[model samples]
Target: MRNTISLRIADFLKSYPPFHLLEQEELKSIAEEITVQYNYKGEHLFKQEDPCKPYFYLIQQGAVEIYQNENGKEITLDQCDEGDLFGLRPLFAGKHYSISAKTLEESIFYLIPIQAFKPITVNNPKVSEYLLSSLASNTHTPYYTESPSRGNLDLTSDIHELQTVHYNKKLISCSKDTTIKDLAGLMNLHSVGSVVILEDGKPTGIVTDKDIRVKVASGNWDIQMPVKEIMNSPVICYPASLTASQAHLAMMKHRISHICITEDGTPNSNALGIVAEHDLIVSQGNNPYFLMKALLRAKKTKDLKKIRRNITALLEQYIKSNIPMTHISRVMFELNDATIKKCIALSIKKMNTPPPCKFAWMSLGSQGRKEQLLLTDQDNAIVFEDQDEASYPDIHTYFMELAKNVNKRLLKIGFDYCPADMMAGNPKWCLSLSQWKEQFSDWVKSPIDDHILLCQVFFDYDISYGELNLVNALADHIFKVTSDLPIFKANLARSALLNPSPMGFFRQFLLETNGEYKDFFDLKKRALIPITDAARVLILEHQVKNINNTFERYEKLAELEPQNRELYLSASYATKVLLKFRTRQGLMHGDSGRFIDLKSLSKEEKVKLKRCFNTIGDLQDLIKLRYKLVNLI
Candidate 1:
């Protein structure tokens, strides 16, 4: 029998993980052994290196401050608020506490006996995993996640743009009184493009390659004169912590290169390093379309890798500029397509001869649909001209090798290897035009979950490179086959409804119940995927080919159904708004915009999100009614 107090404790524990994984009986039993403790504000729970407590603590109310002594100075590590679990790491590790935990305010804690807790988690993998994550500092609110995209999507594949600029640490600077000739000698010896003029070890001015050309070489000033006479004053300075995107933007905004790094983030401090525009271009990949041209000139795969870094920065720029996702997607898709084509062209040159036959490299799934805002796994396939056994083996070998090179290069450039092994390199996907038609026909006729999934992902493909006729022929065959199979359309519609309504009965956003992102709202899963999935199924029913974009699909739906025009138009607006919202979140957090921290949202943002969910609910209702999917649900 459980007491009221024990039951209440169990209820609170059930909301969080490890504890959440426990059975009701187990929870009640464990809760009975839990002891309650109270702490005043600014009171220490445990100091660093203190012996581990017999009980692990859970925050019942208020907050806990976790800090560590780093180099004789206290550094705050994290804050554990309501329902947050702490002081469990040392108990599990059989060691002293590595961090000091204290109360941030007047707090109540439920201290569970480690003896009771250990036995419960012994056989529970999820509990054990959650405990390990907590120990590793991967803390999240009981029913919430920490950052966007940590729930599912890894929108920040290239963290380069999000991180601090990798500046040149070598200080190529001279005293302000140094002669220009001496500064030139120092610059030549270091092979630096710019020379920082330091006054009392602090950067005061900078002289660049342009200054050397215009001011000194042009005889506006003599090289033998003091460097300060020709040096540009009030040098653009930034802190060492300046991000790649910020550095790039600063250079463009100030119309100058070579931003000097200072300790205090001002020229009043010692010059630490110099970050040039050329360095930013070399590191962050200056512009997206320019990076596309750079891809063409790339002789090695590493060059493509560098340009891809720039592409991520450009993505940040696009999001910050509030560019419509449609325009951004188109530009990004073009850049990606251009990269693939260039890689293929280069691979052909590496071969003993050109491709024996014309073929089309097809970008499937998100890339196929031109909705890839982030660089995810490469989902692609190949379709070649049909040929008899005579020329078949040669063409097959050529395309296979080409795909292998392209896939490997794509991986090197940031796209993860698709876990499902769905790429042109896979023989099942890499096929002749007739074979691809057969594949599509088989999927449509079968209409099983697996087959329907294949239809959804592969059917959206566009010609990335090679022959257009091959892809067009395949697309024509697909619409023709899908038109004949109503069951397939029904299956897709069911899949769209699988995402569930994003909002709850109380009009609150439905949060994920578990996984690493427990309690975190999945914006992509709940909102974006629902809309995109609905769009895909609806567009497929109308036999509308080539519009893989979610918003565009809704737009086409509006045009097709005038009676349901308002609903379709509303879905279109909602889709665009949701995409923009997700991108903004992802860019802000440097994560995939899938999982969102609801608490971090402003009141206005929350209202906008709720409004969007309302629209999504309506769209889903439309899906249910139009497909007659009430029975399926």
Candidate 2:
């Protein structure tokens, strides 16, 4: 007979994962064994290295925090709320706890015993898998924290590489004798990209949309010809047990978009299904392929705006899944790049004439660094090749009109206008190659506060569209001018120290005292800028050009300065943590995520954020001493 408390617990358990996978009888049986416990805010459920309690916890009422002690300081790992599970690590490892769990608010918990749950995990694969996913999600940090090659951030260890891909079981096929026109009809009717050519149940060859478009639509071949005329013979085939990585490799090797799956892993065997590049992308869950395709097909600014929103959605998903920031940033960067390119393409069509001369569209600031994960203000410039002075006016006027159209369209596409008039449409930013080189040289020679700030923004520029040589020329000019100037480097490093420490005298976050964000921590100014500024100065000192991403800069700095590798690597990890934190905050509140409210954060969250500050403080000290900024400033 079930007691009222046990019944109520079972009802609650049914609503969440792993528990929902169990039968009603099984859920009740497990709930019968759960021991109810209560704790006040700040009470430890279990401490680091504590013996494994017989029961792990399920939060029933309030919040809990999982944290670990590193070098005598507590670093929060994750926070849990109602319906979340904690204390499961030791149950799997059969060792003392690696971290501590504590209540963040006065809370009630259903402490599910290990014995009651262990059998369920063994009997139910779905339950075990769900629990393991939960464990994997919460246990690991976003970027690797303790690997020796930590600077490199190995992205090759993708889980999708090992996971089996599900292919299209409904194979669309045509006989070798079928007319190309009928084959096209078959593919159009089925809404499939490729059609397998089969004879006697065995695979023969394949015809794809590309084949039809290139061969028939291009007027190179008649549609009345048999498919055998255009079919890619000896179809590249894989076994039904093909993984996404394997499929991707095969696609790349053969330079084909589709692969035939067969009963055996060869073309000689009976065909089973088809795996296209599209299938592999869809299987990955967050589809960059679809987004890129949408960008290419986008005809108007509104279409591009909708696609940019999708990119944000993808970013939010990536953050929630704990995808490595290195991977997430690269994906977002590419998508962002594609959107900018598409915008330029659409804008050029609006013009009555083509570009007067070859020009490079430079995306500056966070967009330039490829660190932008959310919609932000436009920061862009234009660098066209130098032309004869007599023709320069016409060229400049033409490009200015082009820049205005692009900026206005970008504004329409959700990238807000630059508040400081820093975009390409501004007459000051749109310039010839020689003019940009002169401008950069002047900034480096001057090195005042404002000039240094402009240098910081412009130096991270990457070519979004146009001639690469012009952008490369500007970069070469920057490195050449700043190469012999020690004082310029010193001033640049001094600028890194301009922001006060993220932590105040009491070691609390230095919150903004007066502004729209009063009492909110200035995350960008206090933390991100310091690290970015330091990286730029250090990388420039090394004369390493083109590597603009902040974390990548730190990684490069680590490699270049072996003596300071650990510190540089720590700075890289801290950049990831801060960016991830900011991205989360932005997604949660639908804002820029620059100003974080102290009151809204859990104690554990505050601790996690504080961990990054140590790295920033150490980095600034290094800059101050190395650059002799102490004496100069």
Q: Model 2, poorest ten-residue lDDT window?
A: 140-149
**Can you give the TM-score per candidate against the true fold?**
0.57, 0.66
Tell me, by TM-score, which candidate is best: 2
Residue lDDT tens for model 1, 530-589: 888888888887787667777667767876887876567567656766877887787788
Residue runs of model 2 more than 4 Å from their true location after superposition: 1-285, 631-633
How many residue pairs clash per model? 8, 0
Candidate 1 wrongly placed segments (more than 4 Å): 1-285
Clashes of 1: 8
Quantify all predictions' global Cα lDDT against the true fold: 0.77, 0.83
Native-to-model Cα distance after best TM-score fit, residue 92 in candidate 1, in Å: 66
